[model samples]
Target: MKKIKNNFICKIIEKDILKNKHIKIRTRFPPEPNGHLHIGHAKSIFINFNIAKIYNGKCNLRFDDTNPYKENIKYINIIKKDIIWLGFKWNKKIKYSSNYFNTFYKYAMLLIKKGLAYVDSLNKFEIKKYRGNLKKKGTNSPFRNRSILENINLFKKMKIGKFQEGDVCLRAKINMSSKIILMRDPVLYRIIKKKSHHQTKKKWCIYPTYDFSHCISDYIEKITHSICTIEFQENKKLYNWILKNINIKKKPKQYEFSRLNIENSLLSKRKIKILIKKKIIKNWSDPRLLTISGLRKRGYTPSSIRKFCYNIGITKKENLIQMSYLEHFIRNDLDKKVNRAMAILNPIKIIIYNLPKNYKKIISIPNHPKIKKFGKQNIILRREIYIEKNDFEEKNKKNKKKLFINGKVKLRYSYIIKAKKIKKDRLNKIKTIYCKYYNKKQSKKIKNNIIIHWISKKESIKANFEMYENLFTTKHPEKKKNMLQYINKNSIIIKHGLVQKDIFSKILKKYIQFERIGYFFLKKNKIKNITFTCITKLKK
Candidate 1:
């Protein structure tokens, strides 16, 4: 373990395995294939994968696919893509809990032969009622004293589909009066007559409980340390109980850390699934949803996501991270990467009459202002150019800098120009403005007027830009009584715009800086032409 940046888990490895060079360090990231991977999962991926990389160990990508009803093949593929996209390479074969079903069944039988586990006929609700809360101790079930031979027959029957759902459950026969409720004879297996599993299809009707399978899966895979979030801390007692009764010497020890909690967003998979079902959001990949696919579609880079996780690090304490803290890292990552271009949203035309007819002048501007080697793009200076409509005000003011009657505004990377005339039609809207360009000698006299970005009216391509905000109105949206009450009504706003024709194409995934505007990403929609999504603002 590296002491310079040692996390709590690494310290455990140092004490447990470092002294004995024979035991190699190994870890695994096991995610249930139920939903799209979220940013919270990204933290776990970084911790598991990077720790292995740092210690010259191995990290396995294992899917804890215990629930066949909720798990989908599509979700598994998306998860695989997401992990690879985040720059973590796992074993090509991959691992699944369902793959160890036969072994898990045998382990259960071993516990039964030792009179440590048995088949119980109690329904789930009755069992939950008997398993009292923190204030009280639980009562043992009537079926807890069943003979080992009877339990073996019942278990085999459950596995062979002889039992229906809710009929019976196989449970670990631990002390019912234990302080932790999970140790009160927790269910080891349940009967579910489902036919199409992603990996194992219709071979068995019984599935192992997460509590029973998680620890054993790690043991079967020969993992050194089993790491998970703090919510599973209480379940650790149950985790160790299963491994202990089996008397496995070369097994893994579980470790827990705080999970990621971001303000104004909910990370619960079940809650997110509710939103999807209610049509509150478009889908899992909606730009405001914050899932891995959503973030990728909204133009967040993989490197930025990885950096955000690193900066947060691993802490024993749980804290709600401000959304702006994450925004800061992405803004910094994109600053020196994407090239700059000029785009005018809600543009108004400006005609420069000083230039002669049938004449054009080509001017150059650096792609990246700080790095000269990024090279320059050549744009032709035409008679007409497009500037934002907000740039032209009704009257000239001394404090505000815009295209006024006497205000001399510098066109970016070009000569100085002043508004000579204003034109508008119905509703008193400003449609066009006539301006006069200043020569090299006259340009030196300008002052106080701010420069603005624009694109040529004759050469620029039209585009639609979508600006996205948080999906929820409140900072803690999940706490609301009604989930719909706190939804942001206007989470998305669309506006027409014009971008420099020399660079922006109808289809491009690369990030581009739109001059005074924020960085943007071109959408991958084939039905719609030339649309951009706002990544973040560069105001900081």
Candidate 2:
């Protein structure tokens, strides 16, 4: 385990605990099971889990699946998988807000009996009108003065599905004149005639609101620290108010932290669903999406993501993390463990002149230059080879930096080669470059300016290389006039490439550096040919 630093927040938390200000430090990550987890969720999971780990306390994984209309078992399963993938484990059994439905109902009844809450019969519009503005006090609802017996009877009828949707709601009896709009007699329960919940089927019709259920749930779980995003900062008053009013054994402290926001991506589940529905994106796991599954499909390791989040550091202020910073972490991780291989994306055929026609040999190359014990692989050497087309220059007289006719360049892990002639098609596009190999031991000469990757024509494996770039051209895709217009049309470029045949014999999930190119992964397409997906590091 890494050492914990004495930061201000940590110090504050420790001081509070030392003075017996709070009990055991218990934190919980309460995610709504409506969509796949994104980068923002990663931050919350890290903070909650790491805080508990540091304090020798406990962190619970709780799904706030209150909205049955939007929540699903699929989302719940994916969220659990993502949290475990990021290397976190709940101290106790997984929990859901719906699990406390009966307890929440009892609490609501208690509030009604104590004259702190009541059942409002006003419709949605009338209820909002009575709730009033922030500057003025709201008028009491016509049913606000109903007898306690009458309110309890009506509430029981609501549970029996006798009330129509939005016809009645249970509202707290707090001051309606308070400046905080949320504190102005907020609704505790509402009527919803939607489908039954996954856990409870038609057991009750009255469902508790988030503001009412969140605090009560934390209190029930005995959570000492209720960590949440900044959006809930305003609701803190209500959170504490509920705890203070309720006869709970312990009161949980509500702390707010900035939510993670990535550039060029939308984190809202509704917006992502719209994109999926409109066919703007292929699916939730589209490479362009910032979901955990999307990043996994793009060949990112869980460790890389965890490292990226840890290095970004936890803070209260909102920060925009650059895509480049993420890429830098991934590149740094792959550089240490990935084996080196040769692959030519834009292949230009190279025919060696003055070489023995029947000669075929295998040249040994180190799998990793830095690790000798990692061993080597044999790459077939032949008279005909394929090199990247960009390696060759048409006008050698003017541009002397690259490989051209009669120019010498070293074939990586092999002898040096000099271009003798170039072949062009009818349109004058270079088709192939005829080169001649020279043994350095015999000639005592070498060229260091240009080094290129190549594969033997006889033993090369045909590969479909998909190179990816940023999905959006702008940093803020949501703010653009038309997000679809900002989609990088050239984000994915396909190329018919070739790699050493030996590279395909292994099924390694590990990253492999393609000599002159970038890192790549062998996709699980299982075709006779391999699909090498290029992992383009985001520039920092």
Candidate 3:
């Protein structure tokens, strides 16, 4: 494991250990299983799990599945798979907020008995109106002063499905005129009718709100530190209030860090759902998005992501991170690990007129330019091969870098070739280029010549390459009223390309770079055609 850099969270943990405040440091990564995990969640995962690992402590993986309205078992499973794919494991068996449904109900009863909470008869809209905003003080709900017995009875009725979904709820009896709006008698429990939970199905109708469940769950799990994002900083007061009013012997400390916000990206699940609804994106795993599954499918390695998170560090101030910052890490990672190969995306046929018909030579090239241990790959150099269409020009075109009539260019890892003449089809397009090959000794005579990647016609496989760009055109798409309008028209460009036939023999799930092209991952390997997703260009 790399040495974790000193951050504010680490400093706190160090102080706690030095003061003998905690013998065994414990943390938990609590993700709500309502949607797919995005890159932002990955930062939290790195902090909690790595903190525990660094301190020789424990970290629990718990699902905060309090909201069953949009939660699903499939989401829970996918979240687990994503975490595992990112190279992490929970300390033990996974946990869920639903696991403590009965205990939460009992705690709510305790609050009522102590006259700290009461059943509110106001509907949601009315409750919001009564809660007021930051500028104005809220008015107490008429039901806020209900007797303890009456409140408990109403709460029981809510549990037994006696009330409609939004008819009534249980609210903590906090000061209505408090400066913090969230402290103004926040709802502790609400009724969701006929909706079954992923873990506890048809067992209860009343569900605990996140503000009520989170701190208590931390207490029950004996978590020493409850880490969350900066948005939850205000809610930390309610988190502590629940723990304090409940008279817990040992309370966990809550710390906040800035959430990861990428430029030209949407991290919110609600907004992602909107994109899916409008068909702007296919699903949570769309390569165009920054969802963890999406990144994994797009050929980003776990180590690269971890390194990015570590370098970014934890901070209280929120900021937008550039997309290039992330691309740099992935590029640095794949540049050293992935094997090198030759491919042509816009191919044009080239025939060596001087070579005999059906001539072939086995050529060996290093899998990695610098790493000898990565070994070499053998490709057949034949008389008939395909180079990129853009590599050749009909005339000089004022650029001596590209192939022109009678111009000489060196093929990557092969002998130099001189374009003698070209064959044009009836449409007046360059159909074929006739070239003459020169051996290694004579090839050394050519100076300042451009080298390009190519593949033999008979020894290549057909492939579909999906090249990706930022989904949004603007840097801050989320700030706009209509993010769809900022969608880049050419975000995903599919190109029919060719790769070496034996590339399938290389390791699957490992990224491969086409010389002078980009890093790519084989998404689908079929008998006739393969699908490769371009991770990033060779340079940022």
Candidate 4:
């Protein structure tokens, strides 16, 4: 078993279990099957699963599929795939809140029996009007005084499809005058007609609201530490209210930790959907989006995402983490783990001025600098080679450190070379650079300040790189009510590059580090577009 890293939540769970030997440590990752899990969900996934692992407990993969209107089986499977891809296994087959629909109805009846819930005849708009705002006390609906028998009859009719949609709803008879708006007689169940549930089909017309079903589902599953994001902090009250009023024997505890918020990242599910519907992005898995599949397609390792969650840590305090902070973990993950190779983004030809006509040999370069276990790969080094265009400059600028013409610059994994002369086109653009390789025996005599990477012209393959940047122009995209106004037009930029022909096979199989550039993953199917997503250029 992997050693579990300690955090504030872990400390709380460990101490709780230590204090009470009778307490069972069972946690869960409950995701609504409405949308794909995003980077925000990753934090919750790590926290719940890692905490359960630390205590030798079981973690359940629960789907909160109470709302059937917006959910489908495809979403359920995708969610399961994401959790498994994140390196976690459920103790049993996937559980759904809809599985306990019968029990939930029984609990609703229990609420009515105890005079804690009633079926409101008022329509949706009237209910909202009665439930006043933060500044005013809510007015009670006329049907709030309905007898328990009448409420039960109406609720039964609701279950039997006797009423149209929004005709009647079961709401908890909580304090309407209370300052907390959520406690003001929140709707427990609503009737949905015509639309069939993905799980339950047309057998039922009434479905439990998320607030009413979430806590009960936890109680039914015996979840010990019901952890969630801080945004649900207000719902914790309602969570306990349902379990408390129903007199549950074993009630699950709800705890909220700060969610992962990154600069310029749009995490809201509704916003993501609008973006996709508007065709601003290709899909939910577009590399610019923060969905787990998007991150995976962008070449982010699960281990890196886990590390990022741990690095951010768990807390009640809210903050926006810089995007660079997330990239740091990816860098650490890919640095030593991936094979290193040279790829020139902008190729410029360099010809050896005085080498032998038949000069050609394979230059061996280590796959990784420190890890010898990765072995090495050989590149054919002919008399003519291609270097990055930026590596060659016609004239030395003031306040410059080193010039290729005056001083010898070491070619990565090869001998140093000095630029003897440069040829230019009619427009005075650099066409070719004539250089001579310093003697290998006396290379130490040459003063070389910088090392440059290059690939052989004959041995390199052409490919297109689609580099990515932040999706939004501002740091806090949530602040902007109109998200389209702040769309980053330059989020993705395409450029042609030259990578070694030998590395393409491994690139298709594993992540490859482009020496001075960044880690890259091969884009599936498209041979010319051999790039997944680039994080950022390496800081030299």
Candidate with top TM-score is: 3
| Alpha carbon deviation, residue 376, candidate 1 (Å) | 0.6
Displacement of the residue 525 alpha carbon in candidate 3, Å:
1.9
lDDT of 1 by residue, 191-271 (tens): 878547878888878999899999999999888888899999999999888999887887688899998888888788999
The whole-model lDDT of each prediction reads 0.84, 0.81, 0.90, 0.84
Show the lowest summed lDDT stretch of 10 residues, model 4.
398-407
Give the residue spans of candidate 3 off by over 4 A: 1-3, 397-400, 507-510
Error of 1 at 491 (Å): 1.8
Residue range 1-540, candidate 3, lDDT tens digits: 554564788889999999999999999999999899999999999999999999999999999998899899999999999999899999999999999999999999999999999999899999999988989999989888889999988999998999998899999998999999999999999998768887888888889999899999999999998999999999999998898888779999899998888998889898899999999889999999999999998989999999999999988988999999999999998887778888889989999988888898988888888999988889888999999998899788774578889888888889899999999999999999999999878887778458877899999878899999999999888788988899998999999988888887654355788888889988888858688899988872
Query: Alpha-carbon error at 268 in model 3, in Å?
Result: 0.7
Q: What TM-scores do the predictions have?
A: 0.93, 0.92, 0.94, 0.94
Q: How much is the lDDT of residue 189 in candidate 1?
A: 97
Q: Which pairs in model 2 have colliding backbones?
A: 324-539
lDDT of 2 by residue, 259-375 (tens): 777786777777789789988778878766778888877777778888877777656787777887777877888877778888888898998886788778778878888878768
Q: What is the lDDT of residue 268 in candidate 2?
A: 73
Model 4 lDDT per residue over 63-134, tens place = 998888889888888888888898888878889998999999999999999999999989999999999999
Clashes of each: 0, 1, 0, 0
